[model samples]
Target: MSTERRAPLDRKRVADTALKLLNDVGLDGLSLRAIARELDVKAPALYWHFKDKQALLDEMATEMYRRMVAGTALDPGDTWQERLRKSSHGLRGELRGYRDGAKVFSGSRFTGIEHAEQMEDTLRLFTAAGFTLAQAVRATATTYLYTLGFVTEEQGVEPLPDERREGYDVAERARRMSDFPLAARAGAEIFADYDRHFEEGLELVLAGIAVRFGGS
Candidate 1:
C-alpha cells in the first residue's frame, strides 16, 4: 500500500489550520501535536516555523486581527464619536465570531506590521478629534481594552442548562430577586439586550472622552 503525502508546511497554513481546529477543541484543548496531526505531519515539523506554542498563538492572533482590521470601514463624513462608535461595534462583532476568539486574540502580543498600522490608524482617529498624542494613545488603548474585556466575559458566559431553562424565565427571576429590593429593581435593566448594553457602554466612554478633550 502506498502512503499518502501532504503538501509542504508554512506558517500561514499552520495558523489557518489551527484556527479551524480552535472552533472544534477551543483554545485550551489546542496543541501543537494536534495541529501537526491535522496537517498530517510530525509535530516537530511545526517547530521549524514556530519556536513554541505561544509563537504559533501569536501568529494566529496577528492573522485574526489583520482580518478584522481589514474588514472595518471608516466613513469620512462620520464625526470622531461616530467613528469610534462604528469601530467599537465592528470590533465587538469580529471578536464574537469564534469560540474563545477574544481570549486567543487577547493572549497575543501584537508585534506584526499590520497591528502597528492598525494602532496608528486608531490613534489618528483620536488625534484628529482634538486629542493630544498621549491622550489619543491612552484613549485608543482604553477602548481596545474595554472591547476585549467585555467580549471575553461575553463569550465566557455559559448557556442555561435544559433543566434550569424554565427557571430562568423573567417572572421567575423577578420572584427570586423580590426579596432583594435593589436587585429586583435593576433586574430588567441588568438583563437588557446585550447589544444595547455594549452600545450604551461605548457611548459613555466616548462621551467621557469628548468632555475631556472637547470634541463635537
Candidate 2:
C-alpha cells in the first residue's frame, strides 16, 4: 500500500470501492474490511458513512441500478408491451454485465428513491395498458421476478471448457430415459440457445398478462 494521502471518504466513495472489490472477489467473498482496505481506510472508519455491510451493499445496488438505467431512453410512443420488453431485455443485459451482478442486485435491500420512482414508472405503464393499479403492481412484479430468476440461473452456470463439454453425458441420459417421450427428445436441446430460450419464456409471461388484462 502506498503512503499517499487520500481525500475524505463518503458513502458513494465507499460503495464505489466496494463495487470494484465485488468484481475482484465476487459477492460471496466481498467483505466490509476488504472494501475499507481497498479505500486505504480502516474498517471502523466505514461505519461513519454506512451502518454496516448491508448498508454498503444497498448503496452498491443503487449505483448498479443507476448505471443500468443511465442510457435507457424510453419512447413516449412505445406500446406498453414494447416498453416492457425493452425494459426486460435492458435489465437482463445490465444484470449480466458485472461479475455476480445478479447476486448483488438480489441480495441488497435497495431503498433508494430512484428505485422507487422507477418502479412507479413501470406500474404506470401497466396501468396505461388498461390494468387496475393492483394488477399493474402484480404485473410488474411478476415480470421482474421472472427476469431475476432466469438471470440468476444463467449466471450460476459455470461454462465448461470445450474439451470438458464434449465429455458430458446429457445425451446418454436422454437415451436411457427413452420411455419418457418428451424428456428424451427435449434433453438434447435443453441448454442450447439461451437468448432464444429467455425470449420465448418472456413471451409466454407477457401473453398471459395480455390475456388477463390487455384491454381491461
Candidate 3:
C-alpha cells in the first residue's frame, strides 16, 4: 500500500489553507477546525501557529497584501497621482479576488512588519510630491479607505465574482422607488458598470486630494 506524506504544518501553510476555505465557507464559517480538516490535521495543530481565529485572519490579510505587492510594480517615474491611482486599482483587484476578501482584510492587523516596506514607499511617494508628513499619511490613508469601502460594498453585492446576490435588479429597484422619480431613475446609474463607476469615483477622489493637498 502506498501512502501520501503530508507537508509539515506551519503558519504559512495554515494561513494558506484557511484562505482557500474562506471562499467555500466565508468568514463566519471559517474556523481553525475547518482549516485543520482541510490540512488533514487536528484543530490543536493550528493553535501552535495562530493563537486564535483573529490571529489567523491577521495572517490571511497580510498574505493578501503580500500577494498584491508582489503582483504590482509601480514605476519610479510615475507621478504621485499616477501612483495613487495604480495602487488603489491594484488594491481593489486584490480585495475582489476572494470571497469576503475585503471583510477578511478590513479590521485585521498584520501579524508582522512585512507590510512596512510598502507603507514606507507609499508615504515617501506622497512626501516626494511635496505633501507634509502628516498630509502624506492622510492622503495615503484616504485612498486606502476608499478602496476598502468600495470593495466591501462591491463584495456585498457579489460575494464571489461568479455569484451575485438577488434584489439588485435595476427595473425592480426603479419600480420600488416609483414615488421618487429622480431616485427611481438613479437605479440604472448605480447598479451596473462597476468598473467605470469605480474609475469615475477614484478620479473624483484624486481631484479632491489635489485641490486640498497641492500635489501634482
Best candidate, lDDT-wise?
3
Provide the global lDDT of candidate 3 against the true structure. 0.88
Model 3 weakest 10-residue run by lDDT: 187-196
Tens-place lDDT per residue, model 1, 25-94, is 8889899999999998899999999998889989988878777878887765667777777777777877
Per-residue CA lDDT of candidate 2, range 147-172, in tens?
Answer: 88887776665221121234335677
Question: Residue 169: error of model 3 in Å?
Answer: 1.3
TM-score attained by model 3: 0.96
Instruction: Provide TM-scores for the models.
Output: 0.83, 0.82, 0.96
What lDDT does model 2 reach?
A: 0.76
Task: Return the number of clashes found in candidate 2.
Answer: 0
Looking at model 1, residue 134 earns an lDDT score of 85
Q: Given candidate 1, what's the lDDT at residue 35?
A: 97
lDDT of 1 at 117: 64
Put down candidate 3 lDDT per residue, 52-126, tens digits, no spaces.
989999999999999998998988787888888989999999888889999999999988898788788878878
- Once superposed on the true structure, which residue ranges of model 3 sit more than 4 Å away at CA? 1-3
Cα RMSD to the true fold for all candidates? 3.6, 3.7, 1.3
